[model samples]
Target: MDAWATFWGWLFVLVLIVFAILSVAITIGGFFDVK
Candidate 1:
């Protein structure tokens, strides 16, 4: 297997997970801020 490809795949997955968490967090924060 190619090391670069494997590395990039993991990086992409990690970034996606992080982005999802951040988006959910922001949505909750916004709801509280408006209350």
Candidate 2:
């Protein structure tokens, strides 16, 4: 049960990082498109 909790915690953090990266990328892309 402890191992499962740790695994899920890591997965959640990784997902947040990926989501932040994608959001930044889309914002940058939109900025360039307006140029």
Candidate 3:
């Protein structure tokens, strides 16, 4: 049970990191006028 909990915690943190990176990338792209 402990191992499973740790695995899920790590997975959640990884997903959060990925989401943050994606959001930052989108925001930066929005700043530039690319047509």
lDDT of 2 by residue, 1-35 (tens): 99999999999999999999999998999899998
Candidate number that wins on TM-score, 1 or 3: 1
Single out the weakest 10-residue window by summed lDDT for candidate 2: 26-35
TM-score of each: 0.81, 0.80, 0.78
- Tens digits of lDDT, candidate 3, 1-35: 99999999999999999999999998889778463
Clashing pairs in 3: none
Q: Whose lDDT is greatest here? A: 2
Scored against the true structure, residue 20 in model 1 reaches a CA lDDT of 99
Question: Which residue segments of model 3 deviate by more than 4 Å?
Answer: 33-35
Estimate the lDDT of model 3. Answer: 0.93
> Where is model 1 more than 4 Å wrong at Cα?
none
The predicted structure with the larger TM-score, 2 or 3, is: 2
Ranking by lDDT: 2, 1, 3
lDDT of prediction 1: 0.97
The candidate that wins on TM-score is: 1
